[model samples]
Target: LLGDVKAAGTEVREEYRWTQERWDEYRRLAEEMEEAEPSAKGLIFLDYGKQTLTSDGRILNEYRFAGKVLTQDTKWWGTRAWYIDEGINRIDVLYARSISPDGTVHEYSPDDITFSEPTRGEVFFGQGTAMSLTIPAVDIGSIVEYGYIDEEYAPEDPELFQPRFFFQSGEPAKLSKCEFEVPAGRELFYETFLLDANDPYIGQTIKELPKFVGTPEPVITRTDSSTIYTWELRDVEPLIWESNSMGYTTIAPSVHAGLYPDYSYYHERFGRLHREHIKITPEIDSLARAIVGDLESEKEKIAEIYHWVQRNIRYISVKGALASRFGGHYAQITLDNKYGDCSDKAILFSALLEVVGIRSYPIIVMTNDAGFMDRSRFPFWGGNHAINEVWWDGERHVLDATGNLHRFPTYSMGDCDLYYANYVRGEIVYNPPIPAENNSMQSVTLVELRADGSAIISDSMWFTGDMEAGYRGYFEYMPEQRHEMIVEQFVSQRKAGGRLSDFALANIRDISKPFLMEFSYEVDDYTIEAGNYLLLEVPALRYSFPEIELSDPNFGKKSDMTFMRTHDVTFTLADNYTVRFVPERFELSNEYFDYVANYEVDGNTIRFTDRYRVKKLRIPISDYAEYKADAEKIMAYVKERIFLSEE
Candidate 1:
């Protein structure tokens, strides 16, 4: 985050200077890079950059690039976009000029920049507006330079202080430097991940790093009134693209500095605000009772209230002051309005649970898709969303009411494997990545092959855990009349001539029970024609594999998680045809994945059972070849067709 204060922002200095000697150094660096890495020569690369954090909590983020139109690929580098949150930060452009190859310069004015919706990249503007600028006239070599100061003189919450920096960028850099200056007596908790070769905890999260001891030791120097820490890197390479990569944060050379001693300190400060907003009134008590009136067990009662919040509260992205935005408004206020953001819903949910004598805490977290976060030792206020955690039956159940659709005790997929914290625990808690079994789908299908080369297929499916939320959430919004059309669309995806016949559903609305759905469809030309045989594979069956290519020898491992799926099917043929051929029965098991398929034949019917389980999520670089081979084999085996010779 660039800044956190609104009105009390910083201003850039009037005078700025750049030396001709600096340009000469950049030119030499660019020439060296072009010769060494020809593949990257046509792409843009950073020549020089510096990020400085002042003792007064202000930031000076600056950059200078080797700019040229060597190819169409480098043309896009002429434009640059910066996110400016009018409410949280005030940004002042220190200098934005392009020095032509002929030593002439063109500077951009205030009128040249346009404000629009902010985009998430190296910077997360956080629901703020963005300012973009397009450089002028760049046919030959150029040196583009720009710098800005983000002022957050006063933050909404003084206790919330997290100033982090990533030494690595999306593009290669010749020189990059970062400095942090804090008051001499002020202490900060910090950690660095994958920063350099000296880092022992590379590609691993070290939950137990000694306090204040970072691998890439900075140049420590003390001023009369402040302590300055400096870190520098030279000839840094860009992070190459990898399929299903966790995120740039996971691989970057970064350091996160926390103002507080630990997570407990931040919780003690903000948790009080959280409790203040969750005021449980008589109205909340009455509603809590009414929700679980018919429910029997504690799990049922919890499910009822959780689902009630999901269905009732409408999500509105509205934030006022810092207190209201972070701690949320009163529970009664959210209930009265019938709409609120993620934090508001979480506050209301926790309040209702308290009314029923249940212990629940509103936990703040950065979702899995966002990126990995430092769990607890360093208390950084980086979480952007809030959810509820209920303590019942000697266990904790994580629940999210924001998505507007989720079963009891089951988090939305994004909510899993998150860095979670709450005022109640006063400690660090991270929901480790879940196994495939935790979120799974099971299906059964019955098919009837007719004499005229047509087939009727009926599927009964059951979803559990996260998969349940995924399927049930989609149909919850669909009108009853469109259910048939939706099922028809799914069928048409498999076969063009497939038409929906009849369908039935169970537990679509009643999330307390496992989600179950049944649908049937008819397909024309169901089998391939041979001289004396009919050939066809099972209908309504497909595997869900990551779309990774085996073509790249330089490809790395996958950091993404896959799910578990099981399918059982029964197929019957007309009296005129015989069950002549069936796919081979096979079983394959490995550390990362497991697969088993069994095919049985009896009389004119064929039965098949298939189970695919992802034992582990990430496929490391060393295991990529083996994982790819097994994945490809499964894809091929599933495509094997059955040849039913006519008798």
Candidate 2:
């Protein structure tokens, strides 16, 4: 489709010439990485590749990697796919080629590249675009290299231009570098981070000012017209992946460059950009009052308004809406369309709360899963997502109405326990972490075993925090036809011939309370019956425990992390058969996690109770071995079964 459009990247005004010395260096690096990571598919000769920012607010990005494919699975690396935001930039494929083991070179044609919309998951609208091509005759042991450039012509705010370079990735690199050329009279602030995954001090005090994380050591070159700054790293190994580890962005060595003076610049600039659009019109006021309907407590009013926007406003991305990559659309326009994205929802919710006499400000968040956003690092556009912060009764509460599942004071786990930047508050503030008890799941199951090894079961499960948000969000967005099938599928998942009856859900749309699921189940054979004995265990609960595995070799070497998983279960049995044995109480407690399960039996009844809670968020490597061993015991305890001998 881009046949006639002018290509900016492929012309190759100046491209790197492959010399014998460069080729020899690549061979030596390839041999080193292949021996160290024999199981890896490929190794990069150059990563963080070629990046240059000109003085006129235009940026150039090019990656030239002479990487050897160790396996057939990665031969597709020769199939080029370049992501672009065509709305503001033009791209050119300067060069692409593949060199086989026997030194056969297959050069790719830049003219062969074509343009199409990028494949983002279910996102129907955006400035996202892509360029593609297929290099000929690439195979295992082939070294493929490619380069491209994208130039942004129109930047809404040139002063807010901040470019960050991440030097480390999952693929090991021989060398990675970023360079910038700026004109005289303009000074750019630069900070380089060198976070070590194995450093106990860095991991334990990541949120606090980390000592070894940041250093502005850029190589500077001066000329009469301009100055250049460069940052480089060599012999960089790939980051190791560990189970339950924090995001790689936390440990990745990176350099951030920005012209903005301080963090307040972001707060002031963003607030002013969207301030004109966040007006509370008569329509918004009427809607807000109607939604609250004389709710007296400020907290109640906040919940009513937050939940209203979540259910009423549809979430759909639009090009140029937040594509300027900051702020939101008008609150009135969002209410008129009955739909908006995350930023739009936050804006509308903020306006509605304002109408109800509650003080609120829109804020930006970098979400827990995205990466670590250190204030010590020069402040740029740190958050990838936007929400709102409210001040009520001398307390600060950060809330998100982007999804319908979360209740007041509880939000998506991603938005929980992170630092955020708000326009009103020029200083960065911390949103205190929600206690593990708030994000919990409680379940109850009653089983009655018949003489023929069949059982009738009644089940009810309750959810709060993220647990409530996930299931409720699914039901809210899921198709109506699939709802019944989803409920029925739970029965068969537990037992082969099981059927569900009297299934009911609570608070699916009401975000004021914990989400609840209640159902009755009947299974043909819940146990194996011998001549005089029945072998049975607790019925499989719908939600199982978090799969905690420390099998990865890098577990202790990588950053330690703890997930919030609090679960409580109670199982009651109604039967006349004499119980021969009851499993003893099993408890494992440590700084990492807490687990306990015990059983009680009386006359013709048996009660089994289980509770598990995560005690810490960051588990140091020193404590991991003990945590791993205890975790294994809990895994075994849950699967343990008691033999029943009938009278």
Candidate 3:
């Protein structure tokens, strides 16, 4: 079957043989593919066989193809694959050519001195059909072809061959369905976009360029059913009502029954796995002993173990076959054998912690690649990653080991917004975080215009706990470059009147703390003008506010929706400037808690301060109207311009 397919195309010919030697060679290749799980299209593995092969599907002269002697004897097996081409070429191919009882075909184009013609042989197994080839190697040439194949080894579906590209998530969505409670005036809107049926990539496709994942469209929209897409709309009330700070709302009985893949399916799969693998692991035994031996410190011990597992095991992505084969649940395997996927590591770590008397469960997280996971919808393959949930001392904390960061148990700001599936009180609920905001920094810069055309600049900044972690991690990855980049951006804010020649930085206070970055800068000729009196303008501090415009017609006369971030900065200028202007203050005032902004001056120095401390975790969208009013006022103040006037 494999050999005959190679012969049909003018580009190459296929041949096969059924001799004992040939059988042994192919058997090894088949086993290699099964072991690596490269069945997911475009996954490339390299050959570690006795013989070395180049990435361009080239075999060294000393290798054998179809039992025909080349330059040397073929020693070992190497079956790595990537989706280099679509159609018949994309299938598994052992070397380039095969010879059995069918016919002979070209497998590889070698850069040989002789340019020898491909030898003819008989086909043994597959003949006349384009054989699938799996070449295990890194570097799938940056771009590859993608297409669909049928179960019968025939080109069953739409035969359009297209170029496929890789996309990673950009910024993660900060809000999901789990964040809010039903209020009398506010309606909850939910939208989910499915991938195009024909898209080569799985999961949502509305991603920023270059990266596959990022913030979902703030405004939910639609796309083709087969291609990755989003579901979003105007203020549609919730199908089921929720109140208080409850974990989740139950889908109606009718909805549950009609929903695809009922909770019962997950329950059974998880239950069986727990009975078989989890119940017998040493992790369980150790945990049981810990609980009984020392009741006093069991809580701390369990927390420590949970943290340890997350730190030691890094997340390697194994999306396609692993999920399909494992029934889309979490389980642990050896790090060496485990392949470092999100669920595999989470399951292992959770079970390990469980053995040590810690209560942990698998967490299903929709990666940045997929839009938010709405519990209202039933999906089999929406989310692409899994984490672990630990409920200790009545508090739930999420753990992500597969992230691209280090020394972090919790996810970053955007990552924290993913939905998870957990057995809560014997029921599976799609869980999102209670908070609908992200951690970030707010940096305010103040520029002092001088008569000499130079300026004295100062900056103040604050960070959230998670933002600090990310900042520090980034610095660790590239200390000099990251630090300089940050410093440069700050200085750029000091736009001078002319092409400033000299640039200087000073008073860079240490930012080792977990939630704040404080520093100031002094530069010369920072954008000064030479017309009578000097003109000075102070740049507003960098805030975490979303970039919004109210002009879009798709949305009704509603203020743009924004989320929370971990920052607040204000700039104050002394009234001594010839041109006097000041920004107005704004506030988010509710009876419970408010984030207010105000400015004050004391003698030579001006003072600006911003306060952001939301009292409640969840804020209903009905409250957005009031919040938007406050935010608009504050932003207006910040956008106010200051200029220098000469007498």
Candidate 4:
């Protein structure tokens, strides 16, 4: 079937296989497309996708598209396809041709297709190639349509299959469809998620579905020995990007289909495969020993090895069949290359820990805004990142080696409060939330009010846990000169005419200690003078939370609002001035969060200390009004000022 499809085209090319002539032609066509259509950079008219799965273990996937080239931006619409390693999957161009505005057809031949390594951005290990060709005669107002078939053979797990269908894209699609077919007796399950609750479903399926509720249950159907499912949506408007969104997968209407029976079955199978790839060799043992030499404690040894990989190995992104999708390279390959993607780094790091007699496993996780996994919905393929989980002192410590600038023992920010599937343990788990103390920022600011209203300010800050990781990363790659400039700019922003005098940083490289930064600057006309009184506006020494307006129509319409942070600041006055007034001490506590602030005057110095804690990671949308009221009280307290007068 795959061969017949390839033969239907004028030329058939193997996946990722391209000639030099074809490469030149691709480049030439890109230039031509750019010159002809500049505004059409993001124009995509039609995208049709299909996938066919057979009970015998053969999967064929194909994508077809036709769109106008309005500007250079639309050049990306040219032909491109990615496939796993040929050893595991075979890809062929069934047909690729373009129609000009004049209705002339230009058919591409297999000899004209080119193959090369897919670009890896910040990934270290990659295994697979890309086949791409820019359709000829692609000009303004011209319509181009091309498609290819990617057939994957999974003899090892013939019953394993999972497919996701996205109903929306960056550009509005005039028409789109998702089709799947499986041989008889192969049970099929599916669930559909709609971004907006108000959007209606327009797609059709052979099997009658019950009224859509929350994520509809899978509709099972079959004709004789084969089961076929089809969903079609037309005139889908582009998804509007939202700030702090959970990503397209969560926001767009889509369907997830799988053939596995349960989560444990999928977990155990994938875990076994991952374990096979992380076998520790003699070289790995020796290297681990060298890296952790004389490190007495288990914690120290783990930190040493984790930091070693982060500091030594560079991260490069590789999107291919094995490394990008289902499998990863061996530990030895990643160690020798000194570069690997998240999975490669995780595998090598896990192996190194194993050699040192430490129990560790590579776990799959979704980073950033990929959203959380639904354990109830078993056999779902959702995680896009891999990290290591080490068992030490009867506790599990989650570590991500990809954070090159992060300190050990501290998982990346936002990593907590999410679901993860442990490959070694063969179970799904939630990462423990970082304690408020662990994710804290402490700062002391000294303010000297001069007789002339000019003042000098010095600040000392200490960051720990995830907070430390963020600053450490910033300082690790930033140059000394740039650091100085950034400090100057920071001070200037707060004190309109502030001039940086001295700056120093400590404990940046010492991961065991909290990261510290100290800087002093002088601000001209820092205080307003009226008669014998000095008006001193308190400077915000730490990050402030943005105001949440409960009045907004869409406020709390989607996910909950959750964050944790602590900031402490102190201010002092010169001996020449006596403090006359200060904001009263106050405390606010609620189910979702708590804020405690106090102010005191000791001789010529006034100290202000406040602590804010978010008790719940997510506050239900229904609780937005209450959350906003509590947050507003904190904002009001921060706005308080102090008054001083010369004796």
Model-by-model lDDT, in order? 0.70, 0.69, 0.37, 0.66
lDDT of 1: 0.70
lDDT for each residue of candidate 2 in 1-647, tens digit (9 for 90 to 100): 24423343344344454456756776777888789777777787765444455667666665555678878767877887766665566666666778887777777765557777877656347776787878777898988877666666555556666777887666666667777666666777876665444433353323222222233477888887777787777766666555455566655667777776587677777777657667889999999999999789999898888878877898876747332346778899889988777888888888999999998888888887765566645675657788888877778888888876678777766765567888655757776556667677677788887766678888888877777777887876778678778888877877788888768887777777777888887887777665576666766622232324544334332222223443333333335466766679987788657777787877657777777776455545455556667777777777766557655
TM-scores of all models?
0.87, 0.87, 0.50, 0.77
Instruction: Put the candidates in TM-score order, highest first.
Output: 1, 2, 4, 3
Q: In candidate 2, residue 418 scores what lDDT?
A: 65
Angstrom error of the Cα, residue 37, model 3: value is 45
Work out how many backbone clashes candidate 3 has.
Answer: 83
lDDT of 4 by residue, 311-393 (tens): 78778655455433554568898788787778888988999999888988888877645654454554564477888889899
Among these predictions, the greatest lDDT belongs to 1
Candidate 4: RMSD over Cα atoms? 8.0
Off by over 4 Å in 2: 1-40, 48-51, 83-87, 120-123, 195-216, 321-324, 376-378, 475-484, 507-514, 528-535, 541-548, 555-576, 615-622
Q: Considering summed lDDT, which 10 consecutive residues are worst modelled in model 1?
A: 205-214
- Whole-model lDDT, model 2: 0.69
How many clashes (backbone atoms < 3 Å, residues ≥3 apart in a chain or on different chains) does model 4 have? 24
* Candidate with more favorable, higher TM-score: 2 or 3: 2
Deviation from native of the Cα of residue 86 in model 3, angstroms: 16
1 or 3, greater by TM-score: 1
User: What is the TM-score of candidate 1?
Assistant: 0.87
> What does the lDDT come to for candidate 3?
0.37
Candidate 2 lDDT for residue 287:
93
